[model samples]
Target chain A: MSDASELPVGIADVEAAAVRIRDQAVRTPLLGSAALDARAGGRVLLKAETLQRTGSFKFRGAYNLISALDPAERDRGVVAFSSGNHAQGVAHAASLLGWASTVVMPADAPPLKIERTRAFGATVVTYDRATESREEIAAALAARTGAVTVPPYDHSMIMAGQGTVGLELAAQAAERELVPDQVLVPCGGGGLTAGIATALADRLPRAVVRPVEPAGYDDTTRSLAAGERVANAAGASSICDALLAPTPGELTFAVNAALAGPGLVVDDDQVRAAVRWAFEELKLAVEPGGAVALAAVLAGVADTADRVSVVVLSGGNTDARWLT
Target chain B: MSDASELPVGIADVEAAAVRIRDQAVRTPLLGSAALDARAGGRVLLKAETLQRTGSFKFRGAYNLISALDPAERDRGVVAFSSGNHAQGVAHAASLLGWASTVVMPADAPPLKIERTRAFGATVVTYDRATESREEIAAALAARTGAVTVPPYDHSMIMAGQGTVGLELAAQAAERELVPDQVLVPCGGGGLTAGIATALADRLPRAVVRPVEPAGYDDTTRSLAAGERVANAAGASSICDALLAPTPGELTFAVNAALAGPGLVVDDDQVRAAVRWAFEELKLAVEPGGAVALAAVLAGVADTADRVSVVVLSGGNTDARWLT
Candidate 1:
């Protein structure tokens, strides 16, 4: 089951994805914060992915997936399902590639996000997240229209594309002559964590990558510890809407389990504090899910004294309520 | 009154200052927003100065002034007085240059700014704004200690230093091949406006610079229209605490009046709206003062259709109440 054919997403694939999305996705800046350093007992290099296209790192994967399609496949369009960020990313990437896109989002998705996704020219299809399956909704739409399904995560190509963020972070850190002692990444389905972990494996051999999640939905944390899949309670909810994935993806967990450090969990109040800190000190607009890694750093989940560290602020497509 | 010696600040001064602060100051990014463009009916490039050192463009001037001082002057130390942003900038710049700093601040200045100033190793001297004068306190300190006083925006070097923001904007915009038709800048003592205006005059000759102010405190606007100086109402106040200069600085006005277009005013509500817009659309944490130029852009102060425009977000240092 774990043979070569089943594992196409090597570091080379991520490197190739980087090349494919070079001009398309934003090479976000690596930011430093003295105030954050004072709080965390270590210097911080913020991978400000909030400034990326579509206000998230999702664009990297979306662009990579859409741009790889053959003309025949492209003509049939692409379909995706996301709570918000991935929807915007896929819609934006498709529009840029001149391929049609249809995004199936939960009916209760943020209004601003829904509006923005549609503004990017993607046809919107909604389903009850509580009852109907978003994957089924998207699959049905794709089956009827002959559109290819673009999974938000879990896919080899998608993982490779998200992995490009790690590549850029490595290069940026190297250019600044900073070898991070630790890299804390916010995890949803572990795609970002897996990608970054794979990139850092060779680049910063001394560094440890950690996945951060909301407290109640620490499936990735549980999975990492148990060496098997785990799922959150079906009714569990979090203010970190973008990080509500039920379980870690199989492909993502395979890489993450190998390279990532102990998983870290932060509560909603801590997440809110992190968001406030981002605004107050870093002057950055960050959504709750994106702030988890920073929240971990600030809360001192790990010993980081006198060491170089990086926290990936992975997304910022938030509703108005998040700001308040 | 307008002799060559008195006119020490020029486009050349700004260029020289940019070189001086090359490694010391952050070269902030020029941000563009499609959503903002759609609302304003034109292309809008935001000069995100909020991300600068000390979270404002004040650092440019502070570093430039401090770094250029003679060895003896540097040893004597630097003195500055500001309600907030300039205090932090001076303190940070002085610490970087190995100069002792003494910041005379109002007793009611934001606690965060005061703490940050102290964190940078500046000695804080608080005065009652209602009775005592910050200027007198700073002058007495300078006179007693032989430390050179660093004026916020009135001095030639300070103006030259602030002008570096424009030098950067011109280059960033040119790299993107965007020639802005108009540039909106938040104005206090007019250092940033003067700096940007001079830079734009030389680099993008087609661009017209406009000074944007909060409605009740349009002193610069009144000054420019009268071809002389004007003062704000003694008791006037607004949410834009960073931009509440009683009158335009003589040196700054000289450059601005010659280069900038008519002034534009945005009210408190409009400023709040722009701040929300920056958070919601640009994914940027912008203070009330920093949001003024953006407010003018979104408020349709000018006919900006189909033309490249730049809005300078001059500062981002706010207390929690501001966000709420």
Candidate 2:
């Protein structure tokens, strides 16, 4: 049970999740990319989620959610709607719990993601992109199969799990000789951003939590300003496909809206340039979406003058076809 | 001063280096890439030196060597010869020590490397590749300027410093649930391999240490049987230019010869494929040299049958021009 008045995720939540998933997940290190740091005119530490299970932080939330299921819910299985990292996360989480998982992904999803979902023993339910709404299909599938719907980014367990990143980041930073002044986290549906924000609020209350999103899909930014949820009708016009979400989640928005200072938008060219920089300077294989926050720093969106700042590298599972 | 009995580096030498350089260089995490582990049919842990200072493991040796210098020698500064990561390592180390540094690099060295060394306030002396040898030029510069030459490898301090990688790997593996049965390290002048073997031997006494070398430059492999250092006549033939040393160091060879199980060689194609695999599957930007150990595993060079193994990702700095 989550406390109503508490920050979306507190140190307690992250601490609990850390202990629960300690053996299952990798404790990825926060690495300093010195070359990129110099180019940005400050210290840049990358919390490498690309090295996470299923190659993304999505696994953290998925594992945390699955692990929290009651015995009856576990018996009934779980379902989710995603065409990317979340699909793989749900599949992997289900496999770990020995529970059935049914993932609803659009027919147009990347072949690599589709193949990986199947490899993890999840039942893939594909729907025509033009005719069916993913949410509607997911609801139908859940109802028919008597499976519990695990809505990405809307649940307390998932948010608490993602908060483990912030918890680790705070602990990891304290271990350093010098602490950072700010932390840049890439925002999508707001799960990662909210998680980090909540953890930071409890641990490093003074450290600024800056959320970064692609230029066109600036719903989170606008929503925070209007004090209401704002959907992006323009959709994602940037090169970062992983950040193509139309709007922020209700629960995630509430968490980040109160904690996130502001959201910064970076151009597509900067995103591409940051991707190239990650490859050349940091030797990191980050997806365009994962590189957005770093891209902002490289493009001067944030406080490049800060002595020490961090950019959470959310994941690295990019499609091979994009490289060529 | 290095003990005479050690010749090159021993457990004691590495232990002292570890104590000296512990705060200077990062204790890079030994982590498992889940997809890579599944592919190998064994657990594959990556000691991410790409995440190290100067974007390679060379910082450990460079920092260790520089920090070991007495006040008198420290005033003389340091000189190094390299076209890649080592140049930046020396520059960064010197900068940390408040000493001037002079680096002799081939004119055709990667632009990024040259820029990085310069950014660290090192005086880079470029030499024509067809005319002067980098080593000869560096030696000449050191003699003229009274600067101490910090060879990329071969020196007892450097080897002992590099050996700290092995020490950290051993400690990290022991804390984890599954200890590695074998350790694969990329061998250039045998500094990293020797260091790792000495440290790994002390902890996992029964585990085998395999030094991975590019097929065209398998001097370490041949030297193991010849009972002497074997020099490559057709030097530096591979995309992995970082591992293109003409021969293993005499001191390092002695240490490695005592503990190394076997030397493994993989083709350029294997290294290239592994680089691509790191990018696509693991989402890591690995240079050809850093990918060689993974290449050996992918090409079935290692006995990874349910045994946990650790591969040293020695560096991530690559000539991005090659991608073009």
Candidate 3:
């Protein structure tokens, strides 16, 4: 196990990020449903980031990263790449801080996300997921316009920002006299899992942090198993567009590999079922990518028996028609 | 204009009920959405009772009333009459407290509610909403089974329980350093409205509490205006099945008439739009009746400009098909 001092993000950094985003980002509720508890045959607490600003936990990292930049850097603007949730988060956070933002998004991202990103006053550049690389597009844009590139997860500051979710979750759970045995976080580039794992290490050391991903995009799971970064097969696709990251981030993987428990993977059908379950049972709208952790829990992939479990519903930016 | 002592439900009662139900019921969050705030042109806080146990604030009242019963009364079982939400609440609460429950529900009530009520281990008796009187049916059932009748919102204990929503909201808002100028509640029998109004009278003296209802079922509005109970036209209908109480409850109106502000009404289309907006923007699965207050706010009928408004999303018990 890596020492806390060696991790890219630490509890102290998460604490600082919490202070920075305290006034700007929402403290989304840690919700519980008796129906869900019965289904899991144990207590289940949901960290509803779907209720977070920009309808995702991405705002925490985005705001933390942007707010820390100097005035000169802020004036130069920022660029980010995401399937949907992070784009909206960056757009909204940058707009709130009076900085222009440009996002490189998948061409087939849910229309609602694209529209909301634009509505936040960010210039959106759509790129084909199969052929074009979003990183190249964002890097080229940043290089051409002299804008700062705000990576989705890799940075220490970004991981610290996302770690606030874990900070809040641990505190909220403690308030309710709950000691969670495990926390399931949706893994994209593994930033959320790594951040949460680091926070949990400080707040609730006994609580295991597990990364959950869609089956085809289970690079984080494979990477963790191999004890090294492993890329997903090229042309792999799933309904969870947001979690289609090629591999775990180098920084995030370093932290997650040391702190996180074994990763969990769910299929598209399980994700769809979880989305429906969230709507019907939890009364929350969760997108396919956001529902992977929930899918793992509902699919009996997560061993929730005789334990208090926290499942993070990461985002809610899907089209209404998809829910129907 | 009502004094704290004069109200049937008071802050003290709500406080006591909050303590009683503290461990049993979920203390739902007071959520704020920037998107919703921008649309209202001011701050908008949502008291998400849709996240409450049994998917509505009804569980608070039901649990409070059922838990307070004597051992003999508990053994005799409990009976309740509701369009849907109250039935599920009473059923679930009674089941949790080891008491048998029977609910009189509208025959046309959402199938989801009916199914969930059964799932909660309640015996459900259905009556034609347009023809049969639910009160009479529940009374008969209670008479036959010697079960204690737990009226949805009429009783003092029930009102006290529902008032806890306001108690929590006030505290939550205070935590966020927000002093709400107005609170909008979706009114059916006025229990929730009266309870909230009474709580706010003590906690937030300057905040105006307004009852919002569907246009055709604006009995609470008319009742407050005329200083007497006003019944809706026979056979009146709207998509808001849960808010179709023929007239305001006598006990609830007595408290509301003095404590609540003038009522607000929204048409079915406005309500439908609010439900869709909740799904799209707020990411909450609010039923039509629960969306009435939100509809009033979204339709520009609530005067949200330059003031902090709290809208109560009362329930989430509609069929998924209806959301589509």
Candidate 4:
């Protein structure tokens, strides 16, 4: 297992994840709009993971991780730390597998998501963002309870599960006779971008896979440029609560560095504008974090070049107050 | 043509309309949520027409009507009168067919919808809701410009096109092996409800197709009870702007009276709640007007009877301010 861990991920990992998560994680639709196409100067297909169960693509990885746990480990339950989407995903996945789960979340997480996670039967442990470490709390809990710890994105299983998104999107696009010229994916710790890049490289060889980040939180971009894993500036934040990871995951960065094209960035204003545009045009509810890639498209980061562009709308757990 | 118009709509008409609109109109998906099913005490399938092209099922009817026009009539263009959804649909359809279109809209219609219709290149004529007749305005414009008047819901082509929603929903549900026990549709001029009822009766004979309307504009409910067509109370209005038709259409009402079950009603508050619920739970942006059937389900207007329930989320042209 250690030697295998040293090896880079392949399309086979993503294919296995798809089989593991089938019927459990939703196979979201790829939608399109003429208005978006006009703005991008090409056909823009939106793979709306917003419609996924728990309102994000995070569920695919979370569920895959939980289901892959050994029976004794699953019976001992699991512990995880997340802002919102991942929390709901793990909670719902654990509930489905009849495993007890404890999620350590930041106190400021969206109430709608907190309530939803609780509704899924996971015990929630809240911590202060600036003063406390959710990872420490979750680790301590796992130690005491003998529960398995499921890291959000660093693990191979998690990355492989997220890669299934690229697999599904490629097939769905091919079914529509659309071979994407570019695929823009929202990045946090680079897990999603890494997985998608690996899958797209195998499926759509001509497709350019790039990572999108918020302006001040462009750790992935800096990391890609520096040819190493890097961290976002401390104490910096954006409206995208779900995408505020401090640094790129070691394994994820390794995959993204080799497979991903260049990284792109969008400011908060552009993200908000994309959120409003999604409501007005695409008719999908996209959280600010999830809107970054779309914002990049609308902001011309990909420079669509009159070719077909595929953007992943990764999540939709926006606060009620943010809708306006 | 006149005799064909007099005949009640059949499944064959909807099937032919589907073929006509294959690549033109979007074939919307039937979605489901376990949380929603648990709340309703059974399974609840959502036919999300909100993601349809032009943001509503109205696109189907509008495109079907415009495409059926004779070559000479097409060259002369088309004129339509609508609250908003149908206006955008007709405007978009006309633009796609290389025809100029004019739409008579209410002065108080949502600014977002009005702007979108104009953006689709339709000429807009706004009139005071209290004292003006949009139909008369459209008729006059059609006569002056030698354009064909495309009535929003009354025409045979329009009804047949709208019925395609039922056809698509039935087929999608069948793919999942779900036979709906109750299919609840929002009622405006009753075209959608009538069309869906006709299609569902032929496809899913065990299903009960019901109409849902805003409380004050429950003309279809009153008409169904009275065994005759009836008009809404003069000057009645509700927040469900798209569902404010003065009365059911003659041909549409004929279909509904024969196939649909007793109509249900929900207040504006209930509609708003349903819209919010759709965003929060379904991760879909549903407008108030398009949420009435879901409102009826949430408000317990449809008891669901411990069986599979299907509700149509018909549009997603929400005003920005209303989202908050």
Who wins the TM-score comparison?
3
User: Model 2: number of clashes?
Assistant: 1
* Per-residue lDDT of candidate 2, residues B170-203 (tens digit): 8888777667889999988888898888787777
Q: What lDDT score is found at residue B19 in candidate 4?
A: 91
* Candidate number with the higher DockQ (1 or 2): 2
lDDT of 2 by residue, A41-141 (tens): 88878888887888788888888888887766676788998867888888998888888899998887777778888888799999986688899999988
| Rank list by lDDT | 3, 4, 1, 2
lDDT string, candidate 3, A1-324, tens digits: 967688778888899999999999988999998888888999999999999988999999999999999867777899999888899999999999999999999888888889999999899999997799888998899889999988999998899999999999999999989999999999999888988988899999999999999998999899989999999988787999788888899999999999996999999989999998898888999999999999998999999877899999999887665566
lDDT of 1 by residue, A36-153 (tens): 7788787788998898888899988989988999866678999999999999999999999989999999999888789989988999988899899988888888889999988888
Q: What is the lDDT for A247 in model 3? A: 88
Under CAPRI classification, how is model 1 graded? medium
lDDT of 2 at B85: 80
Candidate with more favorable, higher lDDT: 2 or 3: 3
Candidate 1: tens digits of C-alpha lDDT, residues B1-324:
234334547878889999999886877878766577788888888888888988999999999988888866677999999988999999999998899999999888878789888987899999998899888999999999999999999888888888888888888888888788888999988998888877777787788899999988899998999999999989987988888788999888887778886899999999998888787778888889889999987888756888888889998887546545
Structural similarity to truth (TM-score) of each candidate: 0.89, 0.90, 0.97, 0.96
Q: Provide the lowest-lDDT 10-residue window in model 2 chain A.
A: A1-10
**Tens digits of lDDT, candidate 3, B41-153:** 99999999999988899999999988888866677899998888999999999999999998888888888899999998999998897688888988888888899999988
Q: In angstroms, how far off is A137's CA in candidate 1?
A: 3.1
Candidate with more favorable, higher TM-score: 2 or 4: 4
Clashes of 4: 0
Worst 10 residues of 3 chain B by lDDT: B1-10
Clashing pairs in 4: none
Q: Which one is best on lDDT? A: 3
